[model samples]
Every structure is written in C-alpha cells, then in structure tokens.
Target: MSTLRIYISNQCPSCATAIHRVHFVRRLRPEQSVELINLDHQDTVRPSYVFGTPTYCLGNQIIFLGNPSEGELLSKLDQPLSSVKQIT
Candidate 1:
C-alpha cells in the first residue's frame, strides 16, 4: 500500500489546513495510510531538497507543495500501482 507523507511546521496555517484535509480524506478512505512529519520535532536531518511545509508526498514522488485540493488528493489516491512507479 502507498503512504501519504505530510510535512508540516507548527506555525503554518496552511499546514493545519492540509492536515484537516488529509483527515477528511482518511475518514472517507479508511484504508489510506498517512504519516505526518513535524519539522519542529524532527530528530533527524531533513532532506535539503524538500520544498516546503504542507507538502504531500506519495511514495517517493511529491504530489503537492502546499495545500492540495480534495479532488486532487483523491485522484492521486485512486491511481493504480501500475501507473505509479515506486522510486528508490
């Protein structure tokens, strides 16, 4: 199964909105998995190439840089594994 990785910071309103949207999606799709990474509390170093807070990563590919529309997220979730290549 694919995971949705959400990168966030405490002070970002957009992050809160993104999280809310993710939870909304989760309620609709219980099987979907989500991982929230709080930049403020990270113990390890963050990748330098990461775009910004409220980023959404599907597998190794980033689907959104900031807040994503519900439809956009759902569409990505609906994509089959055959269509999305797994990145190393």
Candidate 2:
C-alpha cells in the first residue's frame, strides 16, 4: 500500500478546508496512514515537491492538488498502481 501525505500551509484558507476533509476521511478509515506536513513550520527546502498548499502526495509523488472530494480521494486510494501513473 502507498502512503498518503498532505502538504499544507496553515495560513491558507483553502488549506484549512483541505485539512478538515483529509482528517474526516482518515477518521472514517483508521487503517489508512495519512500524514500532514505544515509548510510554514516544516523544514521543507524543495518548494517544488509541494507545488501549492493542500497538495496530496502518495508514496512521495504528488497525486492531487487543492481540495478533493471524498469520493475522489477514496477512488485514488483504492486504485492499483498499475492503473494510474505516479507523479514521481
């Protein structure tokens, strides 16, 4: 299984919504591992890795940007790697 990482900026309004959505989804599925990275305080040197706030990275590769719907997030997680190309 791939890991999910959400890159966020605390100061961003959209990031706040994205954060809530991600947590809600995580709470529904406790078995899934989801990590949040706050760009404002984290030592993130490569801004390119996180092109913008509220970006979702799966297994070190960016998969989604901005706020994603619950269905979309779940679909991506359920998909096999062979079906979709990883951004990395």
Which prediction has the highest TM-score against the true structure? 2
TM-score of candidate 2 versus the correct structure, residues matched by position:
0.83
Show model 1 residue runs off by greater than 4 Å: 81-88
- What is the C-alpha lDDT profile of model 1 across 4-83, one tens digit per residue? 88888889888888879778878988898888888889594565656578878787667778987898888888887557
TM per prediction: 0.82, 0.83
Per-candidate count of clashing residue pairs (backbone under 3 Å): 0, 0
lDDT of each: 0.78, 0.78
lDDT of model 1, residue 28 = 89
Q: Write the per-residue lDDT of candidate 2 for residues 1-88, one digit (tens) a residue.
A: 7768888886788887777867886888788788888888857654466778888877767778887888888888888856655565
Q: Report residue 47 deviation for candidate 2 (angstroms).
A: 5.8
